[model samples]
Target: MRDLPTFDKTEIIRIVRRGYGIRVQKIIPYRHIYRLETNLGTLFFKPFHSKEAKLQLIVKAQEHLKKQGFTRFIPFIPTLNGKPYYCYKKQLFYLTRWIDGHPSNYDNPFELRKAVHLFARFHKAAKGFAPPIEIPDFLGKWPLMFKKRTLELKKCRKNAQKYPRPTPFENLFFKHIDYYIEQAEKAIELLDKTDYVLLSKAGKRELPFCHHDPAHHNILITSTNKAFLIDFDYLIRDLHLHDLASLIIRNGKASTWNLKRCEFLIKAYQEIKPITPEEFAVIHAFMTYPYDIWLLARARYIEKKPWPLTYYIKELIRKTKNEKARQYFLDKFLYSYLLL
Candidate 1:
């Protein structure tokens, strides 16, 4: 793990103790995580860098879910002043009762199945959450986002083509630019064909708040085989299928887009929440977007960052190698499921 910023340990301890009315015996820092051993119990403390309004919405959403009898989510513990977080040195931090469980092991089929079912249950409980805060128009701008990413890909291709003495990274980028651009254009076409606004409007009455980042690491499995979701930083109002697509894409990458594994995941989730045909089409469109490829291209070719361009280029190449399997999976499962 990269070295994280150093903080005044005494100040943090004092803040936690005073704000939450707990006795913190020790504070162990692991990367960006602060594990506190307190008289009340073990607490996990992490930095809250998001806006206060967003943080408030997250806290309120968790409270709403908990009130709806969803015990699997960890709610933010309020400070002594009834605030959801404590601000020190212009940085916000929040605490939660530490779960004595590891992240769900995606490699284990049984655990993976459980995680899928648990996610569907979460969607069910998260329905009807209307945060007072004004949610962003992310769904309304879906096509625009895809178009912007496609433009970025085009710019990257142009830059790579014009470089007289291109680096190895540039060469690899140039090699696959055509394919990536094609995939991106195809994504935009699919988005144009989808009536996302109508779908969103149809579900407005019971619009589900999605866990924007529902990767396996955010899923906790207790020693007793119970599963819980952590990390609500990116919670937003969207189709629950957004969460499902995120799960399948991330897990499919781990298995090199294993068609059987992807099918199993969809089936496992369906057992809890059956997906309609139209919803399946939306999911397929989302899965076909090649988000990872676009991100890598932009990071390596367009953006200036501390990381070496070689690293991003290598990732792009790795993803490109797995494209065949991903395409096959999409054709076999997504198309067949949509009856297209």
Candidate 2:
């Protein structure tokens, strides 16, 4: 792993004290993070990846949430110069207070329900957020993107067919390519039937933003069962159902593709904010899509993940271990989806 910049101990301490005005007792490095044991407490310092203006937009948007009495977001600590970030040798860095919590347990029913409620509150609070300039707006991109992925899956199937010497992974991929491709196409077809294709308005009132990455790590649960969302880096103005679909996929995969668990998550979120019938239909399109298996194939065939053949085989098997239940889950969700 790469260390931080080649700054010595004195230079590092000087940088922190001058820019952030905090007296550091020790500087600890863990991978890409610099943990500052300061007089204030434990703080995390890291180099900001995006542009300064984008960071400003994030700060303003998050600060607005805080003003609206939403306390779930972790705000960026201002620099000594009243900026959310600092520039040293043309590299950007920022600091924030650390959360002393572990990753949320998907296996815990209580924590998972809390996570759903947290997501609902977050979406409701984000209703009035409107950035002045265009950022990473993902509204209306899903339908077209889904169409493209379907075609990409078809191309992978062809490539696998022509391999002079196919590996075990390729053979396994070829075996299931038809099933996943069929699901991808079905997802696209179902999306065409929804109101998602006709969405024209792009304002915050029409479509609220979603905390795009809802993986286990990004969500932290404290002893009080409070959920704290750490990273605002991937917030996008998209359908809130997109976020719910992601949560189901992230958690449902661990539950052996249990349909009842997915239903419970949806019901919990609806207790806070009811899902409209139209949004419910859109979510069905997202949930039934075989995104995980398609992504695994895309990584090996399209993106060319440079790993051993057996490694891909192992991951593919693990991802599809409960395939029989995946089909059942899909059928159960599809029954209600057709009634919609």
Clashing pairs in 2: none
Q: Model 1, 49-168: lDDT tens per residue?
A: 668887888888888888887878887788999888888777788999888999998889989998999899888888877777876535556678888998998887877778799878
Predicted structure with the largest lDDT when compared to the true one: 1
Lowest summed lDDT window (length 10), candidate 1: 134-143
lDDT of 2: 0.79
Q: What's the TM-score of each model vs. the native?
A: 0.93, 0.91
- Model 1 has a clash total of 0
RMSD of each: 2.1, 2.5
Query: What residue runs in model 1 are displaced by over 4 Å at the alpha carbon?
Result: 1-4
Give the Cα error of residue 313 in candidate 1, in Å.
2.7
Tens-digit lDDT track of model 2 for 1-340: 1345544557667877889999989888766678889999999888776677777767766876776677896788889999888888777888889787888877788888877888888877776667775667878888888988888888878878888999998888877879888888889888889877654253344646777888877778887777987777777778777888899888778888887888888889999998777777788788767788878878877888787888899998887777788778777876754465
Candidate 2 segments exceeding 4 Å error: 1-11, 198-207, 336-340
| lDDT of residue 261 for candidate 1 | 86
